[model samples]
Target: MDSSSPASASPPPATAETGRHAYRPKLRWQPDVEEYFAAAYGRDRFALISEALAHPSCYSCIRVNTLKSSTDAVMHKLMDIVSENGLSVGINGLDIGDQNSGSNTHEGNSMVHKCPYTGLENVIFVRGSGPHVLQYDSQPEQSVKEVIVSRKCAESVLRGAQVYVPGVLACSAHVERGDKVAVSVAVEQAVEDGGWAVDAHYEERKGLYIGQGITAMSRAGIFHVPHGIAVEMTERVYQLPSFNGTDILYAESFAS
Candidate 1:
């Protein structure tokens, strides 16, 4: 979705082109904005760009400052930390071997976590899960309270950002600080370009499911506070699987 324009209120002013090949991808972009882009850079290009933006980064890249510590040293420390964190030696172990075929351990039951790259003395690489299907209403036991954040926050959340105080547009009633809440995005379909208005109540179809988080601020604090973390996102809806270890980074230390 193009974040540069207002909510899509109407379709573009018709086009001279016709046919199925006409780049009219079902992107969440405002029709007018989509038309503008389609006008500027053909329809096909516009569709491609829209699709690319929605997907998160495929690989999690890490640049290590070798001056402070060697790559091997860091790897050993990371292995220990993950092991101590209950990854386990034989169960939830890190896949530092073949990227395509590693220990198939599901951390969240849906994700196949692993560290695919095994080289680069100064850097480490991890593979992440992708454009996988995001199950929104998977857990019914979670809190019913919800919060709607701005489109800005939605984009950031896709790139691993927590909901901040200023980004929050609305919240449910009886919400309190430190409460586990389901966080969604206030995605505007074809509303006017004036402003976004939402009541301080929960809507079943409020917005897109980004993930769940713990509220750092209460119902009042969100609108009252100017800045700070409003929700600390814990479980993401669309998670990019994390891959770290020799399996990804082919370093000398990793080889015998």
Candidate 2:
């Protein structure tokens, strides 16, 4: 979808706090499970691992189908895509081979590197930089266009996936196609009824900012469609080079 200024008279921002860091759910484990892990790894180390699980991978790995195309060809194609998108590219961990030479690719802010290990020539890595600062543009008079998504949806979006219609929890009123919108995930809390309830209000404290995108459908269309992309993300707070809307994914069996 194309990107444009958000429509006026949109809903005010949510209760979620504004920041570059992703809003992640706290991990809860059974008493025995926590004890086992804490005993194996120190409590501090175990905590670190748990925290990391809440975030996306720092790098994306793509495995090329050697039967369909060579690694060099895919590398060149990926570099071109990243460069055209105005993201920097760099070659990393390339094994010595005429076809996989670093000089063959252009350089920029983002990085694309070959698998460093042997026997993994078909695999490539695209480095993702993240937690970059984002401005939600929230103000008292001027409202920011927003789309609230499920916790699961936000997790995927942070890891380079697009916002699908089914994952959308709410959309600001008057959000039309091509409008720029801030995306956040609804925080879930357990209720006395034993069911879960999400913080639906678009408050910085209620949800967390994942990134921004251009809507492919209007507020109504998003709910009308059973399944499809609702938002084409332009910026992810945790940046992973995405090949959505491009043939790069189909042409290669990318599994990252």
Candidate 3:
């Protein structure tokens, strides 16, 4: 699906060339197929479904390797990881470790919790929050280094994946290791040459700000390397706990 800006309250203005309405999330479906679904599910319902599918799941599920570790052990390790990452172990105002008191619990937010079901003691749930209001151009006087990634990469980043070299399409001039960069995506678009292009030319690019990260490689290194992580994401528009370097826990599944 074409990822329209999730933070935008409305779509961008119509294009002057085509004079068509603004882009909408349609999963790049054929006209007839989209029409069929719209008719079957009603236009409004189909639109809702398309928008929802473009976003990531709200929570990630980590099924503990019970043979190697206990649930409490895994939980404490996750808390430690959160602390190492500089993320709050608290939900709302309550600490993640304090489960005894319900007074400070946030209604819709949870840092982490063990599965409440009878048979799923080893299942741990990590809650995520999304559609955060990001201040992209907060410092107008300072030039922000930018990295443009593929749409697929941007989507994966929203789901808590780091930016890899292969996914990087463009990087700002002078971008070097340790540089903080604004990460965006270069969505595919038709070209006059009867081909599609995903090149990232800042002003011409139609994309959304997914997150910010510190560069692991210089601009030259990113394009030259065959494969490796390019950017280490520090802040994401949709916040999710990444399980990349965890020892005994991995995101076994996602809860829609």
Candidate 4:
């Protein structure tokens, strides 16, 4: 399947405002046009685009500012709260260890980790694993900045935005001189070919995965840089060194 496709077309016009903006349905093309989109991109792309147009565009997950806390801590705390309150949750298989431990001999574990949230950013604690942040809350008193990291970067670390050299596609044309901007992942659709699936469900897909970094180079210079972090996410939302600090405290207390 060809990975490249044209960008999404312009959305429909907004409705007349009556005090506040009134909701309006997106423009629907004729059946033939709809069929063409489905055939070209596949069903998932169609649904994702439709959803984006229908609602305020939102990414699937948000990475937390890890400088404030570590992902392990946030995840642990999130799980503890959930279990204590008796909540049922479904976690993606990738987040935990492998589902097929009996048959698969691979010693390594799955890469992803799933944590539940009571609300958007409130994380419950899990035993031994440590504390985790459930959601990112607005800190009006404290200045918080965000940036988009590609799924490529997110796969490296679950929280915060630490963009690598290769993942950056295009930065805001005007972004320059350490301007703080919210980073979002670039969304793309997977294509299918014949009976074979080009994009496997297990294979990680590209989208906004984390938020991090400052603009060290101009949009022109990004393509030129060969190494180093593109964006430095001081505050990550996933597992990081902060957990070690918590562990040290626990150890010291126990020793005493």
Candidate 5:
């Protein structure tokens, strides 16, 4: 017998005792606001507004930073790590290799490096270049410090950053010298919901995901000391390694 047949499809009807219903509380809106929304969007404006108000507004984008490391090198390293662990990895478009391939540059100094370990190759290097820092211009008079990472970038270090604590914010919560944390950014998106008004233009974009880091300060003493790497990155999306082992060179440079 076919299951789709009308005779075979017959099932017991739901009894009153088996039926379920949910009660929703009634909501009231101001008459003036309702009139304004009606004039602005016509029919079904309320539903549209309700949907707009509830949707997530933030989007994610990664930055390509050549100063710390080439995209190829980072991609190769990550592939090697992943492959050695017997896991498969894939990016938008790139093949995996089985051996460490020497660095190959594409388009001038910007080259792609390949690894021989996992049979994977050509993963792009992405970093959290602070949103506030504009792209560098050819002008020589520009301050190099202007291109340094932003505070928002430092916060992202909890996701992955080196053990340097000087990058922590001045007013952070109770974080110690060696605690793990997940970092996130607050982003604003424009909504057409007549539910609430937002100043889209005035909203600033200053968040970047830096990665995880180790804390360098005590939770209680952080406010008093106010200076140090509050969190050190461990694993970051952008594979910029923190040069934490250069004590001699750093001391000599400062001494001079």
Candidate 6:
């Protein structure tokens, strides 16, 4: 029953045609925490982490293990490897702006995928694209056959994690393997008193949008199995596009 695997490979390069500004709800920070930070530091410092947490991550940070390999040796090896692999790799110091539009568009869609930035000998930061529109023939808002994952999983998905089997709390009936499905995050109260968890039978109210993914396991396999990825997230509205072929040592670093 362990047929499910994770989402691999960034789609083809993407454009920066982001149209995600409409009715975007802001996730506000708690008042007490904000006040505490403001008192300790200032209003400006208080908002830094809170603001970053609210938005989807636009980059994947990789701090290379300096003990394992020298930074110079790794950087040289990376340059040759990227050129041989047919992806344009630009090494920027702190200049992470105005990336050419052609490089970022993957799967024939649009988002910003910038070149790798190495600000220090051990620190390498690679950028990811989006909050891109999950372009699919969207089903009705009250559509059937939805897969509901817990809040924790939703947070990971916001940060570019695939839908693991253990995170799946419920799924609609007869959901076949490899089906393209809409994913939702269950609200806090979906779990009732006595610590009983929500199941497929519960009349779940509409939940928040994460995005769409391909079903790696059928509905039965998802519930019955204890481990593995339940869905390979394909199109996430809160996109964190992977940087593999172009980013330095990214293949070996992010290899699962």
> What is the alpha-carbon lDDT for the whole of candidate 4?
0.37
**How many angstroms is residue 220 displaced in model 6 relative to the true structure, after the best TM-score fit?**
0.9
CA RMSD of all predictions: 11.5, 6.5, 7.4, 16.3, 22.4, 10.0
TM-score of 3: 0.74
| TM-score of model 1 (CA atoms) | 0.52
For candidate 6, give the lDDT of residue 19.
35
Off by over 4 Å in 2: 1-25, 89-102, 105-110, 138-140, 191-207, 245-256
Candidate 6 lDDT by residue in tens digits, 45-76:
76676666556555554555566675555544
Error of 5 at 247 (Å): 9.4
Q: Where does candidate 3 stray beyond 4 Å? A: 1-27, 89-94, 97-109, 117-119, 190-197, 201-207, 253-256
User: lDDT score, residue 117, model 3?
Assistant: 87
RMSD of 3: 7.4
- Can you write out model 1's per-residue Cα lDDT over 10-117, one digit (the tens) per residue? 111111222211111134666798889899989898778887765556444455556676655655554444444333333244343322255333321112233345
lDDT of each candidate versus the true structure? 0.51, 0.67, 0.67, 0.37, 0.32, 0.52
Per-model clash counts, in order, read: 21, 18, 0, 38, 36, 11
Q: Give each model a TM-score.
A: 0.52, 0.74, 0.74, 0.33, 0.29, 0.55
TM-score of 4: 0.33
Compose the digit string of candidate 5's lDDT tens values, residues 1-256: 0011011111122122211111111223477887787788884977577555432222111222346665555455444443443222223223233122332332121122332335233223322111121222224353211111233333333222342323323222444556554322222233577444222122131232233334555544533453445444444433332212322111111100
Greater TM-score among 3 and 6 belongs to 3
RMSD of 4: 16.3
What is the alpha-carbon lDDT of model 6 when measured against the actual structure? 0.52
Q: Is candidate 4 or candidate 5 better by TM-score?
A: 4
Count of backbone collisions in candidate 1: 21
Report the alpha-carbon TM-score of model 5 versus the true structure.
0.29
By summed lDDT, which 10 consecutive residues of candidate 4 come out lowest?
247-256
